[model samples]
Target: MLRLGCDVRVTDTDNTDKTPDFLAGHGDQNCHIEATTIDPADNPSAEDRNLEDAVAKIKTLDSSDFQLRLIVEGRISRTLSKNELEDKFGKLLVGNDPDEVRRGIREMGDESAPYAEIRGRNWCLRGELQPISDAQKVEGGSRELLIGPMGSYSGDASREVREGVLKKAKKYDRLDAPLIVAVNVLDIRFDRETENSALFGKEQVRYSPNHPEIPAQLVRKPDGVFIQGGHKPRYTRLAGVIFFDGFVPHNPRGSVCLYVNPFGYNTALPQPLYELPHAKGVDGRLNRVEGVDVGFLLDAKSPFKNSGQP
Candidate 1:
């Protein structure tokens, strides 16, 4: 059972009009628990879909009462690009004393400079912060700096930019503390599929396993990868994921066939007997073995009555 802390109740629905397997709390202020379990056969895809649904449900609630916390098992997945990282965190790097740091960087020019005190501690500006004749490089101990012509930067460039910003922010007491980004992987996909495949016949490749390197400090779970934001000094966790199982067909040909059986009475038969000339007996046995699809329960406090809280 999983425990979620929400200030308000949660609700959910599925693509089919069938009542969603949902439970929710009621009151002006209360914690909520949502419990969901699918057949082990539908583990991967179904769990992913459930996580998306749960997150979406939390987002729709009124933001005033309670903060939301999620605990999920299984594999969850998401992709983050450099632009997205910047969009979520760029402003934090703009130091309170921009004018002062800008002057320092400008003074450093193109030289491999030694560290100088920004507030009191030393900082070395390795690259020219101003408009450059060409790409510029700066190195101060373990930190590296680079500046490129406008619009000539990539995502890696932003990481360097943020690092530079953090150094600048350290010099000023008036500025807000550097913002942190946090991520938690509730699950990760271990099964191997095609690693890199082109999407939509476009020349561009999708799902590059070797691209967009992830940091080692982040934790990996059964569902997905989690990433933290900001320079290491001000790192914060930002996201989490829940993994689920996937289903693949045992017989490719049978999976592709679209024909439906005309005998509605035998709809419940297992695959092996469904194709037989006389399958009525098989249908009877199938009915006997089939368990009721007990709906999920959504209580105000606990969702998965089994998985404990994080």
Candidate 2:
């Protein structure tokens, strides 16, 4: 973020009680900074955790013991608790037959959907797993396996962005300076226009792919808070909302990326903050909007640039 035009001076905080994450000054002007992400996936319940652990343990079992690998399907992730999960595993121990274990779970259709597989293990449970169950489960020749943060795209996740911004804004409503919220959209399938609607409260409309100019009337989205009375009384202290998308120019070797925030900036920017050298994000892929400037989208891409053996 230092690479951006918002230059700042580090100042020590004397407050010992409730406060913002940290304080910064752009020249003599200052504000509070809070960082967050745009994730809408519901937290897994204790039952969900048990299912995951059970699947992980099942994956470590000897693959040769069954007629086929212990392919339990991924549908049960959110429903199974430790005891229930143990019962499924115990079914496998009953006869040393893999087919029996597979049959014991379900008929292999409907409620129990195949989520992922590693070696001989599988998981099936009930919960709202995202990217939905229809996402490609087969990778290479391997069973469909989930490897990272799971989610599906649409308006709900974007609403999370709004909720996060408003909540953060409210948290620092009493602060004497402007409040800026930085959101990470790396794991999300973020649509720029959708997020804008969420922020400004516009009915994010869409047209049919078959007819370029044709519009869809019945499915119109309602006005969001920014368009209604939602933003007036609550977001008064919010000075800016910044987005951190992933880096650009993918590669096995590292490559730089750009960050763009379509919204205009805060009113309390410091003179020194404006005076800092502008960052040439992704070698000028991003143009300078009036209030938006270049920024560093690091941390997400930095972890892998090392030898694994250390």
On TM-score, the leading prediction is 2
Candidate 1 positional error at 78, Å = 28
lDDT of 2: 0.44
Compared with the true structure, what per-residue lDDT tens digits does model 1 show for residues 34-108? 222223233334434544443453333321111222333223334223343233222223222434444554776
Off by over 4 Å in 1: 1-20, 30-35, 42-310
List TM-score per model, in order.
0.14, 0.44
Provide the clashing-pair count of each candidate structure.
Answer: 43, 11
Residue 181's lDDT within candidate 2 is: 67
